[model samples]
Target: MQLPESQVAVLEAASADEATSIDALAEATDLPPETVTGAAFELEEEGLVEVSERVDETIELTDEGHEYATDGLPEVALYEAALEAGADEEPVSMGQVIGQSGLEGDAVDIALSNYARKGYGSIDSGEITADPDAEPTADAEANALEALADGAVGTDDDLEEVIDQLERRGLLEVVETTTRDVALTDEGVTELMGGIETTETVGAVTPDLLTSGEWETVEFADYNVEADAEDVESGTVHVLRQMSERVKDVLVGMGFQEMDGPHVDADFWINDCLFMPQDHPARTHWDRFAMEEPSHIDELPDQLVADVERVHREGLGEDSEGYHSPWDEEFARALALRGHTTSLSTRYLSGEEIGEIEPPARFFSVEKAYRNDTLDATHLLEFYQIEGWVMAEDLSVRDLMGTFEEFYAQFGIEDIQFKPHYNPYTEPSFELFGTHPTTGELIEIGNSGIFREEMLEPLGVDCDVMAWGLALERLAMLTTGAEDIRDLHGTLADLEFLRNAEVTY
Candidate 1:
């Protein structure tokens, strides 16, 4: 294949200097590295050069390439030169020259026509001339005059001139004519350049140069400094953190004490104590990230273990019989990154004073949790959870529903529905659903219900404890219209979005 002119130049430079690397040849010939390498490969393949694999690649042009390289220009350049010379000296015949030169048919015709029109030559009797010496008349004016002579009434100006001439000859009569022109006086010119500075003493009032009084004044009204004005300051809170805090505040206002726990905990507290079966699907490697170096709780208090075993093996009096598999103490002791905020609730329930608290001991927690979930528009592998629980002797499912209704109403989520859902821990469970304003589709916000005796009995809590939670990422998506879960992390949490975003009450 014929290489670009630049590549040919690089080949010549490489052969002359005995360059070893394509980079050196490129620098010497001022060509791109790719161009030098490609040209060198082509030259070697064509028997024009011998390439050797030394410490650095080396290339040498063969005898044939050397001979061609010494020539003034390639065949293409020669053809180009001939075409340019023919175009300048004489208007070459389009058909004959195109046949003789073997150039593009359209190119030859265009060159001949362009040169002829520019007075370089003319196409006379199908042959070009160098001395056409065409006239200097403007093409536009010539076309216009031609049309006017043919009674085409070229333009409005031309038609108006013809009408004036006709009226002068009595062939037509003018109904009316008007002309006007405006010009600036010398005073106006001076005023425009330096601006008029005339001033009137307004009761010897001193100008307040430091203030913006001049720009603030109305065009035709007197300035009044005594006008009453009110100042308003924009009030806002950190959006994500504020929302979490607000949820915490609402829970606190309802007499819930805040609960805290570590981000890492053993599976027994998170799963086993909650009555999640050992062989449950959620405990598999696909759903949970099992720690490589698991921390074993080899000596868990015998009382707690006995209570859990009894609650699981027997019916616990509040629910049906639990899974009979021997609890894997080793697996239970393995440390894991907390998968949900509910783990905090379980930790709180494990304390000795859990049962002795007042009738309704409310507790709330807001913290980050991790999972092995695939990242998507509405799902994040790591996010916060707004969780709370209320334990009371008479706390019923209706009370839990009422609490959620009042809580969601603060954010304008007045319409909520529930569907039956099964949670390993919560019996008679229900998944909370909220209506999307735009799509009118019910979105599952979270799950909630009173804790089963099987789950609470293990922790020595005898009263019913109502628990509810919602993923913070889902709430953010609804609030900000952000589709990607990853966007909620890092720098995308700009202050501007938090400050200006409209929050409906």
Candidate 2:
């Protein structure tokens, strides 16, 4: 029987009675393990050999684990210190025990979090108590960490739970390697006994081979789809971008024109036209991102700027009085990253961006907005906002609420509740809320209200206009059951979830 040289070599090295690992076959045949694996798989398909696979897991201590192995676990150290401080008999100062234990920074939190879980002690109201019966020397997690640090696999039955704990605690990393083993069948023996000859097999065709008529007679090796290869993460649209596009489609379907503007724009358009006070807390460095270089805008519509300033400083009519606070043109012209995409709505309404949008006109934007915010599960420093507005003859609070009901219903979100809220731009504004599927907690998703005269009048918009700024990530959370907004995008995003989360809505 004629076979490839690699197949012949692998069969010669494999035993009929004992299964030999691919690594062992590589050593015996003096060929690469991948080459041997491919040949072995081919032989298995031919019924000449049998192939089996098993996963071998190896555990090794992380740097932190190694430190803990040498100096003892933080929880163990805390317990020992507590016993020294007489916490075994009575409660002792947690600071005193922690100070004596020498656990600082995150290690203190780690120790306290685990101390109670291991039945080591109780920590309450700044005091700690250690159980006298607790055995620090026999701590299973500590033992597991030490064993792994000492180059032991910790395969003992009793160490399984402790090993898992150590892994969860980030004390160790477990690597699972898939190992293939090969053994010869009866047919393989007969073929070997019959003596094997080497055949030149073409794995791939070259131009010369294709051009030659001899190619028709040449033998070709079968391709193995199961062969191990490098993982390549091909480019695809992000979940957030897909959501943004879907939002654009939804708004367009709802008879809204798309709006585009600069990510960094003048506060005159972002805030001033929205009637958000120049001295508002959100305009401060605490919430807004301000630009430093070339600090103020070079040019703005003189008439529009004067109208906004007049409305902000003086009474717009006999019944309505504007904010008495100092309003500055330079302040309004100062450039900053837009905190909301509603700045586009402001510009569009003012006829500065697009010429005088007519009544019954609807416009929307799905774009990134920047703000200075602390990172958390639900919030990001930058996010995609679904900004939209409707300018019609007679708009009311009911119209705004109905629009939200219709909008959220398309995403399979029902039972949306509205709570009366306040905004500088909208009167009778309400915050939008939806129940989280996983946590069962009510989460605020967006805010909407009819655009006030204080906002629209300065922009030359005569018709009643209702507007809203919705969170795209929050909508995704409602539809996809994502508990964290970070899971959608950012440094801490879950790659697994992003790759697998279906964009249904």
Instruction: Tell me each candidate's TM-score.
Output: 0.51, 0.71
lDDT of 2 at 86: 99
* Cand. 1 TM to true fold: 0.51
> For residues 224-250, could you state the per-residue lDDT of candidate 2 as single tens digits?
787667888777788888877888888
Candidate 1 Cα misplacement greater than 4 A, ranges: 1-238, 352-356, 480-484, 490-499, 502-505
Instruction: Give the per-residue lDDT digits (tens) of candidate 1, residues 1-505.
Output: 3334553454445442343566667787788876566555545544544445434222233332233234311222223343545644656654454465454533343344334434434544445444423332332323333443344543478656644433222233334322211123343333334643322213223366226465344232123355335566477765566667767777777788988887878788778888888788677664576677646545565788778777777756654877887677777787778788888888788774244455558888889887755333455557888888998887888998999888877766777889999998897899987665645566677888888888887787888899987876556555555444444554234344556555443
Best model number under lDDT: 2
The CA lDDT at 255 in model 2 is 93
